[model samples]
Target chain A: MPRLRATAIIPLLLLAASAGCSAPGANDDDAKSGSGPIKIALVDAQSGQLSSLGAWELKGARLAVDEWNAAGGVNGRQIQLDVFDDQGDPTTGTTLARKIDSEGHIAMIGTAESAVTIAMAPILKQAEIPNITSGQSPGLVAAGSEFLFLNGPTSTTYDETLAKYIVDKQGLKSIAMITNNGSYGKGEHDAFLKALSSRNVVPVADQVVTTDQKDFSAVLTGIRQKNPQVIFVGAEEVESGLIVKQARDLGITVPFAGAAPQGTPVFLDTAGAKNAEKTIVSSPYLSNDVSDASKKFAAAYKAKYNEDAELHGAKAYDGTQILLTALKSSNVATGKALADAIRGTKYQGLLGDFAYDQTGVGIFATSIGTIQNGKLVAVTG
Target chain B: MQVFLQTIIGGVSLGAVYALVALGFSLVYRTMGLVNFAHGNVVTVGAYLASTFYLTSKLPFALAMVIAIAVTGAIGLVIERVLRPLENRDFDLMLIGTIGFGIVLDALVIAIWGATGRAVPSPVQTEPIDLLGLRIRTYDLVVLAIAAAATVLLVLFLSRTKRGAAMQAVAMDHEAATAVGIHVGRSNAIAFMIGAGLAALAGGLVGPLLYVSPALGGALGIKGFAAAILGGFGSIPGAIVGGLAIGVLDSFTAGHFQGYSELVTFIVFTVIIMVRPTGVFGERTVNRA
Candidate 1:
């Protein structure tokens, strides 16, 4: 099969070589094109289940790229941003990762869904280039991909923060966790359970759901029997919203806490404004009140795109800005040096003072916020 | 006891939705002798229309529901006509064709409304009613009532009315029905319209619980198909029975097995298909000439 495939590609390669024969030094000049826009790739679900989050990330990248270009193109070289839709499919993501590597982009930022990021990890690591990811799964960086850097607080971090808040701050005697069985959900579920155990707190109920399963009435009924102080959700926006809404439908009015995905517009919208009240989310971005940098980013994003910048977009913007900052200070930064520079540098952006740990994970504090009357009202920062 | 009661209540609401979608499938199968794969997307389109008219356009919910159902019926008519032109009515081709058309519909909905799901308000409050120590949503009761009413109306249309008798004739023997002056083509079109309209109603009714999105069509589509198969391909009561069975199975599994419930639902469907292809109570009798 491999030999047959290789034989098939031979003609395409010959055609490409025939095309490159137009100019002898043209290929060289093109490779070393001075003052040209530096190509950067983004891989995300532009048309599948996670497309909404993918669009937000794209918008955020555009904002960061435009802001930087407006300020003068990273000291003479403009940024060339390209996008590839992975549809949150690992196979598609792997192919896109190879395409980006073969295209020889300076860096890549993307993959809103963690499974895709993890799928592309080995390919990106093999390419020996910088790849920043905003996905929540620890597996994105945990795959030991030196090139893959986590751009935001991970699911583990959020779960830990949520568990700590409920136990230490709120002083809840018990809690319940409901999550999907996917990679993202499972990761958060285990991490949250671990955190609870570490705190010597036992959850009253633990339920697992599928990504496609929408009805939570049955599960909520069982959980209501446990009657915990709060419910922690480990699902995405749609599923999380459904869980909260159905929980209310089943007459369970306890406060619900969740990770970043829970506090999103779609979650609040799908869950209903009234149903979503008392639903707390752990975020790394500004929930309601904006900091100076956040205000600038939001204003520019709104002025340009005529839309609100969400958490996914905000984190991507910060990640892009960090890449820009790294590219600026070092004129000849490439490959290992670029990755090293990204790790070494510490910059304060929209999410706050941002830096990566030794293992290429973002070290950031968590903020608690709730959807109150259709708006994310920050309780703590 | 409460868990058992709550599971039954939840299952009933879910069963009503499955029944609506399955009823559409059964009607099309009976009339056309072919399963309509696009029935699911009809539901999705219905959802999008409801969101656009009722939620986004600020139209009254009842008015929006009616308009969406009417438009979906029209869409069904168009799809049936489109399929009628094919040179060969091969089962595999028809299956693929309808599925391909459904995908096209999916893309159209996504293009117009975007991929993210949104919530629509229900006439009843989302809050549950305490009925003898069991928690049940008022919305669930409404969905159950609507589904029951629609089923009764459908049964009446097929049994008591002129068109109803004609449909039964066509279902029994299309060529014989045409010889007796019943327009088989017209019957097929009506079947498609009723199927699509029922699907749309199901989508609209489910919006408050599942939220309105093109993605809603997918899982519901499969379950509805399974329900149709389980109950009997051309049996109206079969669709209801099949839907209720599947819904109850799903809720019970979700409560008992947690994450693996979907797997169990499909596994049971697979087993039943392998064991009894004609389904429970499905007529497998052949008329001796």
Candidate 2:
């Protein structure tokens, strides 16, 4: 009886140890299994001051994923999305990128603002994972990161268009430029100067404001002294709104023009409709005019989120579409293969036709929009 | 000259709202010896509640403002009750608690309302009146008038009314007031309620001019705090003066310098602190029985 009992106990112990070892092994196998869905990561600002825009981007990306998965995902494998909120901070963005990289996503679509995207570039590059950013910062592509891609217009393009608009359309002879002092702001300022120099138009005053600034009285006073016919703002919506509101209070009546950051709804809300109405901005997409893809995405987004998708949403959707298309075209599912395929992509999207140049900047056209009656209206292409 | 006059007028009007917000901070700090860091969040809650009433319930603007003030006052009471247990705790711990509470309020707002800057229609007419050669919005003038009335009423109440006198007694000396038959807890509650109501009023006034968003309170809060500090933390008149001064400084700096308004404001604040550490109207305290 004792011998039989010992034999039974030994078999049971071996079975239990095998089960314990296989449980974790099964989890590892589940993660490594190519037959399962391909996971993609999205890291962007989903909280803080820019949360509204961030949520909009999330809605658009989610819609694209839903549509892609429904219409037969890449090679019959569903696409799974893992989203991270960086709160619009560059440091937080870098940390999130590292975490996402370690988790081993096939690719990432994200980082709406230029500052965060530029900070996240090294992490994604180190992991050999390709990422398509929604930010227009040229620095992301300028870094020569083989894995980086930009889906928005660079400051150079926007400045060229803006300078032409102010000089030709508005007939402004003298201009004053007030820009935030940061990488994004500096890029815009440099681009504006270059474009104006090309057109033989010299600015009467060029001034800089720190990003943390809330007051603009001294800057406005200087601009008032110069008495330029127009004022150009190269900053995000919060500072831009404060500038406009304060300018009106200070009785400076120059027409205000800004880049894509000023085109958001937050600008109107923060500065009031009266102040926002005087501003003109350029963007790649407007909510009013919907292409077939945009309309579908908007409908799905509204149904799920009960709100309209803003420009950030449209860009995220386009970026994800480009990423998924490249992944579908490439047979090898590794990160290197995905990066190469993305580099060779020429996909048409909601923003416009996207063709990446050698530097990984999306070669596309931008549309101009004006804030009228508290809504973004497309003005000119 | 007309443009300069209009600019000053506009600055004063904007300053009126800031002054009201600063008054709340000043009143609370004077009485409680604690800076209610959640004061701005209280303002935000008031603005959002008013927006909901105006948009969802279709209430009149006046009714909505009244309801918002009442709701925010209740919230203030609840906050005081929740914090009453920690009254004897260290000042830093209380401050950290308030900061944590502010974060909770901000997050709750986002979860409930989602992250969107909703448009709040201005009750005041949209017409821009010509002041000299410059056009000034009517809503701004109204804000100035309301702030003036609130200041006068608060001053009168504190000076004349029995409850107000008791409140002042408590602010002056909590232990002595309690020994002299004043209910210190009740007085504190009343002071907080009044402060919260003023903050809500400021919120309602500014909501039409600016959209109500979860993050809108942060900058305003910082500025209001700065205004209070500039004015000598415990003085009501100082808050008003300080707010107007900051507003004018901001306008002038932006108008004259174009890009260095923040630096200019910082310089002014630093100068003021250096010149008068006890604040413009603050009394130098001496340790005594």
Candidate 3:
């Protein structure tokens, strides 16, 4: 019995010794590579209605991490990701931001919705952590934080480009606008109005609706009564599709233009081929750009995920690449150094020349696309 | 004048959906005495099921709706069977269980359909019909018509059918009904099935008008619950009225005061509860003890 107990103790001691050896070696390697593995916290609507967008963002981030690791990770340190599901709620987002900030992550990505992102801005700023987000509300940047970076075009830019395309190219003088009553909708509405004012044009009619609203007959009727040459819808895909379908049902056959949120496949699928066929939208990135890099990314993404990547996914991919590039450029691997490196980035991305403004907003390019034949076709204005 | 008319029409169409959802809440409450917080999640499940049929199986819209409703009804039955044994449990426990069930259903939806909002194609056209110098979508009118017809049929069934009366009896006095040969358990199951069917119907109808997401039911569920309470927990007509009123109030409020809509709407709820504790149509129940 004593000999048997001795034999069991010997194996247990060896196992403990091996674990001790590996654990310290791992920590030493992490330290040598800088701060034990770069911790990235991703906050988004992972379990809510907008989970699809979150899933896409995750896929994009994962793709970037995989590529980076394959090519030898940033300064020989592996990337570690921690994800939090905000469920598209601002309060939840704020809490998650606080938690991520306190957890000592190198940087953060997401809180995909504009309202949630804006709500989290102060928390992220207080923590002095850099946040790269896919939200488009201009208010996000207007928060006056150098650490908060918007990966997409501001709502004003999307509105300005759309208004230019409509009033200048389409040559439509009279226009009607219908927008949701959220921060995003209000931002787009104000921006569109400003853009129209610049062109010496004023909308004949404007209608506001809520995000949960399912019917648009009244708004469509108001627009019809005004008899505008064009109708601009400043809402997301679901609401936009309903407006288009309802407008057509009401015999209002004017051309409809949408903001960036209406650029997704959901718009086409929901609005049906007939309603979506001629609908025009301004997008930051196009899946069918035919550029070598764009095609390569598209092919790889489709091969891996078996789905066409949307602009949000592409933005996240680019955003992750930007972070990785910044980390690679700087020898040190601290939060402040990573932030500084990111601020000084000038990498060529799938979207365009990726650079950050002093305010940390991505100075990448955007484009316009139209839904034709149930697919997004790149439209050159 | 035009904006007012349009707002009313939009409000009515939206109210029709709320009414359908509220009816589900009323049906379950009338029979079970327990609030199925998962009712809205059930609607989401129905919508996703319909979408699956429509998109994956290439079923016609009408057929897809039927299948979705049937599937949702089955889910309701399953929930009833699983939960009935715990009926004697604490009210808070039951409520928590339903809430947990809702979360599970929501997560399941995400796993299956992903979290992205998908566009539900409306069977109606985009052309607007002129009514009294106001243009309205044919689909809105269709929704209103469907809601009215469904309500009438449901009222008729509950008032005239033996099965409906048996269910009502179970709701009124479960012990007494059991003493009489009403098969209270079967009535409970049937009540849940009907409620789930109604929710599923609402999902199918509204799918085209809004994007269907896994979380679509969260807000709607809250509103439906509010409507159920505002209409006097178990009153069918009260649920309908309350739902329409809430819908109209929400539309006008949001239209007039964009950012303050949520606050204003909740204020209305608070005012209603304070003014009428038993609700607009609720009866004050006598304590048996």
Candidate 4:
């Protein structure tokens, strides 16, 4: 009886394993013919702490894909956009990269966390799978994978522009900085510090914090002693909000400045409106009402998601649109040919003009904005 | 001097929250000989419950806290009852079971609350008060006062109440307490309820100061365990002292050293544990006489 059971189970196990390994475009014939629906994997943290990024990315990507599909989808072949949750973890991202590669996804979008994107870059490069990411970390560029593309400007560009405004134009010489130890934070820290040094100004206090730290009293207290004109925050939305709120509680009324994360809804909501007021932000996509095209996109986004569009969603939408445009123009090419097509195609996006350089950084400029009355408005000349 | 006072005040207030969580760790370990890793999730549950009640249902903040605490205590009873069958088994089995239970609670928190962080409204005026030329948040002072009142009440109850003494007896010897006409299971249940109640109070109090999110538990849980270990496991006063020490060290290190705050704090804990294996106030013997 035991021998007979083993014989039956062995064949069943083999069949299941084979089925599990099978994927949509895994066949060589399918890859060459460019037949069937085009598969593009959307990787982001669909659950856990960074799920907000994933949710926004999903909505933006879905909106673009749905629009394309409705309009006959790049020469009559529907684009199949599949979602994969990375849990904001690098290890999970690597696993998802391998899965997407084997599953015959021609291109990929997101893995919003910079660390996860950097970790998956090599794997995607080896698989010849071109990916567009929403991560703004300079480390993504440092990864030096031609297959990896960014949807927005790096922290370097953002901080440089911010420094030019705050130092050269406004002349806020005395500054204090509080940053976390995460990949995004490190990039902002280095870029902003370099930008500050270029102007021959040194921060009065530079406090480094852990990424997951909730309390900012100790660090804020230390900064209070210095009494800087402004505090440069090199952290994400929630952390930056906490820092601003705590700084206010400590009676340090200096305005806080940061990159993309500071302008987000999460940051504004976390820090009460009164506390978040006058916060300076540097980003390519300042608001959804920047232009006529932006106004149209924002209307559509709100119509679909029933929520106002933000930087992450705007970037994702722009990235997805760029990817689809390249796919259409290249006649739905794959691998190196598709990558060349993406690089070759130039188009105006919601954020800015899309033009990829050698380092996969498409955009190179960010306008300065400030939070006023609970809304981020661009600083008009 | 002003900065020094501010740091100490900030540390002590944060420490008060840790002390509340540490008390839960001490209570469960004493009566059940189980660390009850799910205590952190209980904290998260309480925060979310209070937030939901206050923000969604438009209940008064104080009333929301009361409902949250009561519900959390009931959850404690349920958890203890569910684990009753595994109580007599190997200690590791119960430890692993509690960890698994914690994961389930964490997942439930996400499913119900959604994985986003919500700002809980502060019951007290969020503005800082001028005290001795130092700026201190009014909410921090309230947190410290509540913790002190809770500690005093806990000490008084353990010394003067029948149920509390029964819990202590059970902690000393399960079989002996069972033979002495004390209902061992009842005593254990009471311990868990009280412990969970304290955790809920901590969560509600700290919720406004920090973002109430699913990951709040994991971040606070490690610090609570460290406070428990530093205080010598089962000692109440020791937990408070340990928590304050850890908070002060964390604040001071971050203030002065900046980059090495966590490293310095953990190193101090490691060195203290290595030098004194039984913790500051831990009993020298395996079983209390």
Q: Give every collision pair in model 1.
A: none
What is the TM-score of each predicted model, taking all chains together?
A: 0.92, 0.87, 0.87, 0.94
lDDT string, candidate 1, A1-381, tens digits: 123224435643653585467665353234224556676787777665677788788889878988788888976778867777787788999998887666556688888888888888887777777888888787765788777777788887888887777788889967998999988898889888988999998889999988888667678888998888899899888888888888887888898988888778888877888888878788887452468778778888888878787788898898888888888776637678888888877988788788787778866577777767777888753
> Which ten-residue region of model 4 chain B has the weakest summed lDDT?
B280-289
Best by TM-score: 4
Query: Which pairs clash inside model 4?
Result: none
Give the range of the ten consecutive residues with the poorest summed lDDT in model 3 chain A: A1-10
Q: What is the lDDT of candidate 2?
A: 0.76
Per-candidate iRMS values, in order, are: 5.9, 10.9, 8.8, 7.0
Sequence-dependent TM-score of model 1: 0.92
- Candidate number of the best lDDT: 4
In order, the candidates keep a fraction of the true contacts of: 0.53, 0.27, 0.61, 0.47
Candidate 1: misplaced stretches above 4 Å?
A: A1-35, A332-334, A371-374, B87-89, B284-289
Off by over 4 Å in 4: A1-33, B284-289
Q: Score the docking of each candidate (DockQ).
A: 0.39, 0.20, 0.43, 0.44
Per-residue CA lDDT of model 2 for A137-198, tens digit only, reads: 66766778888888777888888877777787777879989888777787888888888888
**CA lDDT of each prediction against the hidden true structure:** 0.81, 0.76, 0.77, 0.85
Tell the DockQ for candidate 4. 0.44
Error of 3 at A260 (Å): 2.0
Kindly give the stretch of ten consecutive residues in candidate 1 chain A with the minimal lDDT sum: A1-10
Which runs in model 2 stand beyond 4 Å of their true positions? A1-35, A165-172, A204-231, A238-256, A262-281, A286-291, A302-306, A369-381, B1-7, B256-260, B284-289
Task: Flag regions of model 3 displaced more than 4 Å.
Answer: A1-36, B1-3, B124-149, B258-280, B284-289
